[model samples]
Target: MWFSRGLGSLNGVITIDGLVKRRGKTEILSGVGFQALPGRVTGFLGPNGAGKSSTLRILLGLDRAQQGTALVNGVPFVSLADPVRTVGAVLDGSGAHRSRTGRAHLRWVARSAGLPLSRIDEVLELVGLADAGSKRVGRYSLGMGRRLALATALLGDPPVLVLDEPLNGLDPEGIRFIRTFLRERAESGRTVLLSSHLMGELAETVDDVVVIDRGRIVAQGTLAEVTGAHRSLEEAFFALVSR
Candidate 1:
């Protein structure tokens, strides 16, 4: 288990406490909290309109929280001087320019991060995009685009990775490949947090889970602990959120 920081002993794990989010008068998330540990897959789950994406945006510092805190290594993501080296994230793949080759897009990102060009090919191969690296990103399929986004995430090989709906629009083979890839990353002593609407997929890929509903975390623990002998994770999940 990863220990907390000195003195305060606040867990080095990714943590959010009393997290509240709002847009004008609309509240999106309220009292959201969870911890993501290194070397494990923490599945972030919620139904549509349940604030999963909002929470991920806050974690990436793309959206600031109106209340509470989102921290990695006990520091807010925006406060970090070098976010790329500390955390790797793939919030959306549409950020890439349509006319750019996959390799060129990655090259620019790597250059900005002061990462070596070799790391670009390394991540491309890891994401099974080695053959398509020279192809224009707009010509690629949705799954291929997602893979490119993932490759961008791995460019830094950071200790923490946060992916949102990573398996969406993926083929069966793509889904399986990404599941294995994420598991391997966590096994190598990295933190892996994935948000997915597919609870069944989360069952197969995650070690722990955090369930959100109406912008709140309703359940969190090991898959087994949360399931508690239930026939499936879906069953346990529904039981919690439906409660």
Candidate 2:
């Protein structure tokens, strides 16, 4: 049940165009647009309530936009023929039942996606959860739960990964692991799009950067371009979004 490292011919492009989302009279996103190309890690950076999660939600089809499109490859996520095999997403934690063991939770997901049960072990080990697979999810710590969520995302070995605040609960070691892993994925020609407020960590991981604030995109480009004339990405981010 070994999955290939990369989908050689598969295109893993994420196109977000003119995304506009409104809740009652307040707009959550305003004409947001960006492209996450394959073979690169794209960091979606913003402050809290800056529309980062909202944009990702629309991209993953968990939420709708009022006047824009979020497409993976050539079509929307909801229209993908084999979604589980096309895009792996990590959002809202593990989404696992409290009573289920980590392995059991992965087993259910594998079954639902028609993936081989053997993949469960592979992903568990990949996420460094091999020893904790038998632990009940409810008893796991926040970092452990995040790892399980990552394991679940890798189950299908999708070419595109969309994650929101992926570094939320990770420790230093876990952060290092994820940063290296994501870089490897991008080097292997996969698409990695992640939203996080940890600018220092993201500066090391992302090849491209997109900055959003107050539901609008204020800056976007290669890491160097976005960090132009700034001491670091953190400085650049604050300079861009500070109002």
Best by TM-score: 2
lDDT of each: 0.85, 0.91
C-alpha lDDT of residue 67 in model 1: 89
Across 1-243, the per-residue lDDT of candidate 2 in tens digits comes to: 112434333378899999999999999999999999988999999999999999999999999998999998768899988888889999967779989999999998899889999999999999999999999999999999999999988999998899999999889998999899999999988899999877987898999999999999999999999999999999999999966
lDDT, model 1, position 31: 80
Name the top lDDT candidate.
2
Residues forming the 10-long window of minimal summed lDDT in candidate 1? 1-10
Residues 68-160, candidate 1: write the lDDT tens digits. 888988889887666667788887664588899999999999998898899988989998999999999899988899999888888877778
Q: Which portions of model 2 miss their true places by more than 4 Å?
A: 1-10
**What TM value does model 1 have?**
0.92
Name model 1 segments beyond 4 Å from true.
1-12
State the lDDT at 163 in candidate 1: 93
